[model samples]
Target: MNTFPIIETERLILREATCKDADDMYSYLSDKEVVKHMGLEPYQTSTDVLEEINWYQSIRKEGTGIRWGITLKGKDVVIGSCGFLNMQPRHYRTEIGFELSKLYWGKGIAKEALNAVMSYGYKHFELERIEALIEPLNSASQRLVEKQGFTKEGILRHYEYTCGKFDDLYMYSMLKAEFELG
Candidate 1:
């Protein structure tokens, strides 16, 4: 099993998810506004969040992905989540995803969490690239990825089936070399 040690930044901590985080996870993920731009459906209840936690736990056991709960430096509350999804070890790449509580938006927590994960992917997992598939309308996310040194690769037309329809997505990527230089 892949054991993810807690990663700390100037104002946040990225750590492995646990069942104990179900309520906190639900508090953010279940909010429609928080997940509106994310492709996944808004969680309906705490049990829904628990199921996600269970799924992440299983993935961790298989050493296929790393999922983290985002918490502030002096707080135990989980304000968001960031992780590698659709990890392709043979390809040396993985899709990155994140969600934060609406209240935490604009606080730069997402960027901090993302940087920590990208560093982990490069230095520890030996990943060559990290990618994010984002909705074109999500300018906030686009700016975040750009600030982290991801470049616009291309647009995948009608790429993801989300929110009851096919949505076009912008593909953003950061290479290990690109991240190292920035």
Candidate 2:
């Protein structure tokens, strides 16, 4: 299985998800406010959260991209999740996504987690391009990605179905070369 060692930052720990983390996952996933902008259903119960956690565990066996729970230093609670999705090995690229608990919003934790994950992709996975698709209405996420040096590629019309309707999305990308230069 692909091991996700704990990654420490100034104030957070990005680590693998464990079944024991179901409660933490439920804390965010079950909240409508947290999942409002995320393109997925709010988890209905801890059981649903556990099921999702199990799925994440299975992905490790495939040696592919997986999500990590973002935990604050000195605290056992998980405040968010960040990871790669839609991995395309042949293209040497993957889509990056993240969602944080509302309580931790605007604290720069998302950006820190994103930068760490991007660095891992570039250095360990040999990925050339990392892209983020943001709903046009999610200004916070757009700004976060931009600040992390992801250039706005373009707008994708009706790019995805979110919150029960088709939503326009902004595409952002950062190449390995660009990341290395900065």
TM-score of each: 0.94, 0.91
How many clashes show up in model 2?
A: 0
For residue 62, give model 1's deviation from the true position in Å: 3.3
TM-score leader: 1
- Positional deviation of 34 in candidate 2, in angstroms? 1.4
Tell me how candidate 2 scores on lDDT. Answer: 0.85
By lDDT, the best candidate is 1
On residues 1-182, what C-alpha lDDT tens digit does candidate 1 reach at each position?
Answer: 43468899999988877888899899988888888898778898888888888877776777667788999988998889889888888999999989889999998789889999899889988999999999999999999999899999999999988778999999999999999999
Let me know the TM-score candidate 2 reaches against the reference structure: 0.91
* Alpha-carbon shift of residue 169 in model 2 (angstroms): 1.9
Tell me the whole-model lDDT of each prediction, alpha carbons only: 0.88, 0.85
For candidate 1, the 10 contiguous residues with the lowest summed lDDT are: 57-66
Residue-wise C-alpha lDDT for candidate 2, range 43-97, written one tens digit per residue:
9888898877776676656655678899998998887889887788889999998
Off by over 4 Å in 2: none
